[model samples]
Target: MNHGETAYGLWSLVALNSTVFILFAFSFFKPATARDWRSFGAFSAFIVALFVEMYGFPLTIYLMSGWLATRFPGLDLLTHDSGHLWSTLLGETGDPHFGVLHIASYVFLGYGFYLLSSAWHVLYHAQRQHSLATTGPYARVRHPQYLAFVLILLGFLLQWPTLLTLLMFPVLLVMYRRLAITEEKNMHKQFGETYDAYAQSIPRFIPRLGKARLTADAEPKK
Candidate 1:
């Protein structure tokens, strides 16, 4: 297929892409509680909105068309590559997919999904046994699931930056933070000192640098 072709208006692609990603996340998360579903729902909305603009419509490009045309006069606004705003804005000349930011986005996305899946595994078993989750990614951060969502969102932002998604990013961050706080409150009530000790050691969103990793046996037992 011609690489420069306008590929928008493909709603099937939007649906397919959204379904695949949502299902992938759902399978990993297996959200059982209302709060879990709410978090997943918001993430689903973000994914759908992203894919809609990416494949179904080009609202961001259209909104910036005038400025983009004026700034990069020779650019073909209808071409798919033009939608890669970062490359255009950064004055990169090769295929946008092969650009540094795109490659880095893959890394972020891959690692984010891996973290999500790993955290879910630990959390699932913990929930089944009615214990605190302090293994895998949870050992590094108190809210690995929230951190995973943020990482995935960041990966997408690095790849395709739409105005709507960009605006939604901070809103989602704040929402996740609130949800994390609520989750912590519930955990504290349930596990008491165990949860408190875990929270004290691990950071909320970011992990500490150069900390020695704890073995499974060394982690707090439920």
Candidate 2:
């Protein structure tokens, strides 16, 4: 299989690949708003583009054919292994797909999704009864779900860096930041001083330890 050449990706492969990843992410995210959908949609696009290159069409390989060929004349560009950008760029040999970084990427992605789902579970329950989500993953960070999504994307970038996705990522980060601010505003208004105090105690995305270890929430002692 030529790296930059055409490859046949069966419809079943596409469906299975898309479904597996999307469903995995959906189970964690459980998106509830238009903004959420938009964010998920963008992430989905990145995933699609990634898999499209992985199985369907090697657009990135094709697009960068000249530069890559010039850079690494030894590469076949026909073998699928050439598509492993990280390996080729870093000069790592052997099976790039099964490399340490690749394996670690999956771990980060799986953990991120798990965090998103667990955090969402706590948050959903809290929002239902109009209480602060101060248990489980929420006990440490405010927006674990959002942070999870970011981690998931970071994992993908580590595994496969694409120009389009690279451009979209920072923009999405900014957008997520704005969304987090808006969500916090609503929480502040709804919960009043309780949320303010909680916000002060806990970090938004990064949990603090050492001097930053918080004494859990007023409702949930952890």
Candidate 3:
């Protein structure tokens, strides 16, 4: 595509992509609590901001146009391909979508969504039974859903490093962390020793290197 056919002013694509991803996440997340809604709302705002710069307007590119032109002479600033800042910065050629970081972004996004879905499933069933969620992704990490959100945000950063989204990333991390701590406190109150034992065994956000011994059926040792 020519410069005229490239980034900026494609509001339709922006809206379409944003809607699809937000709906996809909403279906998986099914936010019920105020905290849940807050997290999801923040994520949704990030998505919309990302696509807005991605398709609606190339704000980052426009802001950096002079420096980018001086640094990488003859590069087409208007093209969508040029928006893949990681690929351009890394000096990778050809299609940016097929670049290493781009491919890695896909991996992160796919796995992130998968984790979101799986975590929600386990949490839903556990909530229904009023039991601690220790199955599936929860068996590995205490906050799989929050971890999934981080991964997804990282995936976007890899794909398109916009100024706004990059700034929002660390803020979102802190928010998720605080939310996880609050959730853990509530869980401890409700499940008492069971949650304590589970929390002791499983890391809050990261999984242990080895296989997790904890399972849904495993009884917490008194």
Candidate 4:
């Protein structure tokens, strides 16, 4: 529980965690196109940055040490638990992993990967038939894969608040949004009126409640 001395400076742990997560996401995302690689690369970079600060350097804690020490005098900056900045900031004294933010992070991560996998399955089948992907997760949102990446990033941000990753988050969001727009254009070219109609009915990122759900034969996937 107390990783004060053994928390940071573990390069192996940083690499292990980063590789595991990046590979897990890769397996689900299966980046095939150049655009897909860009999105995957950005997400991989975020995972690496997060793990680097989490188990390798703890740069955020080092930079904010003085402030954190003054703010919470009894806080141990080097402890793994202290790295859960959300818990610390919220005055939660128990194990950071069991905290509310941490629990929510798990939910985000679990569902994010699940959504990513589900979206890929739908897209893959549709692509094989040279058709649009309008079923499953796509029916809920136009860009489920992009939304999955956002949720995953948000999950990591919730678990570990690092300055570098926090800055990268918004940049990734903008990048994904632009990519989504480009993809939508491509879909429009391919599916024409069908895609346009689906776009009108389905929301982009957020799911519209009480709205009519798109049928299996509805819109094209991003």
lDDT of 1 at 182: 97
TM-score of 4: 0.94
lDDT (tens digit, per residue) of candidate 1 on 1-222? 224678799999999999999999899988888998999999999999999989989999999988988999878877878888999999999899999999999998999999999999999898889888887888888888889889999999999999999999999999999999999999999988777777777889999996735544336664
Candidate achieving the largest lDDT? 3
Ranking by TM-score: 3, 1, 4, 2
lDDT of 2 by residue, 29-116 (tens): 7778897888788778877777766677676777898999899987886566776788899988898988878888899898898898
Candidate 3, clashing residue pairs?
none
Worst 10-residue lDDT window, candidate 3 = 213-222
RMSD of every candidate to native, in Å, equals: 2.7, 2.8, 2.4, 2.9
TM-score computed on alpha carbons, candidate 1: 0.94
* Better candidate number, 1 or 3, judged by lDDT: 3
**Which pairs of residues have clashing backbones in candidate 1?**
none
Ranking by lDDT: 3, 4, 1, 2
Is 1 or 4 the stronger prediction by lDDT? 4
List model 4 lDDT by residue over 8-98, tens digit each.
8899999899999999989888988899999899999999999999999998999999999899987888888989999999999788899
Q: How many clashing residue pairs, candidate 4?
A: 0
Question: Can you give the lDDT of residue 5 in candidate 2?
Answer: 46
Write one digit per residue (lDDT tens) for candidate 3, span 108-211.
99999999999999989888887888879988999999999999999999999999999999999999999999999999899887788888888999999987
Worst 10 residues of 1 by lDDT: 212-221
